[model samples]
Target: MKVIQSFIVLVFGLTVLVTNAQNKIKIEYKPEHPLKEKIEGQSSLNFDFIIENQSKDSLKLTRLEVSLFDKQNKLIQQKFLDNNGTAPSINTIPNIQWNSVSTNLLFNPFPDVNSMTDKLEYTFTFNDSIEIKKVVIPGDYEQATDFILPLKNKILVYDGHDFYSHHRRFDYEFTPIKQLGFTGNFMRYAYDFVVLNPEGKRYLNNGKNDTDWFGFGTDVLAVADGEITAIEMNQKDDKTFDIPSLKDKPLALYGNYIVIKHGENIYSMYGHLKNQSAAGLKVGDKVKKGQKIALIGASGSSFFPHLHFEVRNSINHQAEGLPSYFKNYNLILGSAKKEGTTHTITTGDIIQSK
Candidate 1:
């Protein structure tokens, strides 16, 4: 029997599948990299899927089996999940309400295949039967926009575009914004920058006050020449290292942010800024690359003072994020130092402008 699947690609990077069966189950999927990042050494590949029930009867996912293959059709690995009781399920209520279940996967691709995972097979087992989905991965075609470090001098990539970073796990669909009908991972390729002391500690003294942190109040520079599209410069900074609750202050989550339009639909955002730090700048102001825009602070939803930066296709932070690389920087790892130009920097990297 031939199984036909129809796919509808959503604007926000999700591909929705509408099946032929009466008990419809829509699966939305997308890989972090369409294929692999053209890197010399090993790097992790990530992807996720959301399964939504659309049938009158309840559905319970028992197990999820995954098989990965390389370019030459060689099996790299196979694994089964569902250690947490039932894998996923949907409940029927007063209304035709459905509870969606989502899963995320991360793994290093085989180096022999040039870090390429050519194919993926997903077998989803429900209470009655199973369904399979096969996907042929494609190589990345993203023309990464080159940028300059948003801050100058020895900066630590405190949190970056790493597989386990909270930035990687965030998507508007699962956030408080979802209630407002937004759906995209705006910070998928975002970075959090801080300055660590020679001893690798973030602060001194009792560490209770924000001023104890070395990165607090550091000048935030514009990554490129751009027109200021948005600016929020008056949010008050937190008094301590403790992260404040954003339950009632949702807009404060960004903590005095500035968004710049750098042409070609690419916009850069700098968040978690000190109150009134961007005093003279406002929407419609044009700033040159490396211009000082604001000062880093522990404002909004931050636990410590740091610069939260990201590049995205839309001025709206709810849109999809764009991958980017820095023009020139020196990477420091203890006693070793490496120079790079037009390269992607990830979590834990200590970088300085060259």
Candidate 2:
């Protein structure tokens, strides 16, 4: 079935180019490499479809409609591409200029088909005339298993300063990844933790250096017992209070990161650590939960010292992000401390490890 699906997509790709040569717009679907195994009614699939404007005039993308059809050409479902009612239109607000490209996410929900004959049909309005395109998508959809939190007895602070905290919703969180010319892993559940003193301040005194920040140089412990499958430790920490450019130096986005494979298809990623902190560690090293692996640092697209952590289904960045919770921690809210093991930490919640 997988082979048949690949062949269909390849044939569709070759034919799509010729079909759109006379039209002023073109569409193409980009799926993740090494596609995950598919499971019926449990797996969700995602991909990116790009719309290129070959016309000379600027055009407003008023509406984008997508439909899913079974092998018998029966319509299964349909959706409008407008940010789930948050936005007015799809990608372009006013207009998409000539020769420009707009990438949109194609997210399919559960109860997915099990055969390779399923198809996706797109109907979009550009300016006045409506355009249409069709493509054959892989029907194999595998759902990710739930992940357990690995950290214990650790006090983490969230002040709403972290990028992940600010954009926890799918509508806002997934936009950045699309703008970066990438798909999958919207990072809606990613977290960044900082430390605060008793006075609830993130820094000591002037906070001009890394040592002055409460979280700087603090031990970054492994969240779970797992093998170190990947590591990137060469990136240097950004100067204290110096803003790093994510655009100019995109490769340094997650400076000095490590990936731990905790279980089948479950990996925890620790990003933006101090330079050379994990120098002694290498791929295939087994690390126990709570073991000190690195130190927090202001590195890789960071403005200050914090720990960027997330659990993903796959090692690659394109994999879907899974929600993570701490096994044991005391939630601190304005002088109140509540001990809980299954608590899902949120913005402005200060946590103390038990």
Candidate 3:
């Protein structure tokens, strides 16, 4: 995580007063860890920058440009920040306050290197008046590791059915955890599987009782064979609309969850289970794939009964989310029915276990 920063004062006009005004605007950048090294193709890097205005008048930012260089100092690519169709224009900045902006840059065809030890340069234009350039941000890039699907022969309820699923709907990008911080897995690629009846409804009859939910008390099976690394079984199931706040109990975010280490730096997490359903299991216990581990429930921070499933790189939620494919599942996308192994399911797709 080595970082190199530089402060440059660029003066385009001959007027001393204008030079002093340009100096009042300061720009600082913070690059994510992997960007410091060489990044692999199809991977993305994030950049965080702090823009400050020190002058008496407001500062308006109009455009930004980023340049990437190879190890030989050759210009690889140049990119302009695009905010939809129009160039990104920052609101007038009040004096003496810092404004933070971040960008996620994707490298399509990354340079051929084991590790990137090059530099990324940035140029910012303020109100079309002057250009501020900063160079020599140190970082490298590496190839991204591809993850395999860990689950087999398990039915993710909404796979072949449709109902109101929340952040865990796989393709639903507006997840609460993704909004928390810049780093960590934070349920970004997690999926929530809620039971739905044949009528495409989540509950039956009046829905007064928890049993009225279609998938309530259904067996939550192990996605892959692995030793149990962590388990939390004491949390109580919440009544509809009575889900507890995570502020009161932090771990309640994944009430009665289980973590299974499937491989080195790879783990599977099953969250929001029925109370005491996993009481028989202990850490270090070996479980087989498709084995029943717990029952789906509306525990922790859930609004209804569902299974929260995710493939993460680490045992904790702070790790990066890994993409996974399922083995032997039937995917029904409207009128089409595709059945096979290595199936990737997204939001609103009806999936059934083969």
Name the best candidate (by lDDT).
Answer: 1
Relative to the unseen true structure, what is the C-alpha lDDT of residue 29 in candidate 3, on a scale of 0 to 100? 43
State the C-alpha lDDT per candidate: 0.66, 0.60, 0.56
Runs with alpha carbons beyond 4 Å of true place in candidate 3: 1-183, 206-208, 239-250, 340-343
lDDT tens per residue, model 1, 1-354: 122222322422231222332237666565444434443354344444555665554555555666777878889877665434453322211112234433222222221233556776666655534464645364653444457898875888989877677887764445455664445566767899997777777788977888998889888999888899888876789622222333333334677889998888788989889989996999999999999999998777788888899887775434667666787788887888888645568888888888
Which stretches of model 2 miss by more than 4 angstroms? 1-57, 63-188, 239-252, 315-320, 338-344
lDDT of 3 by residue, 1-354 (tens): 122222222232335655776687766543223343111232233233445567666544565666877779888777654223443322211121224322221121122222343666777676565578867455433223322222322334443111222332222112353343223423434677776555557788887677888778888888778899889888788732222344333335787888888888777888888889985999999988888888888777676777888766675424555545565666655556677444335555556666
Tell me the deviation in Å of residue 9 in model 3.
13
TM-score of each: 0.74, 0.57, 0.59
lDDT of 1: 0.66
Superior by TM-score: candidate 1 or candidate 2: 1
Candidate 2 lands at a TM-score of 0.57
Q: Which scores better on TM-score, 2 or 3? A: 3
lDDT of 2 by residue, 11-121 (tens): 898667545643766666544431323322233333434456665545455566667777788887776655335555454332333334443333322223334436666
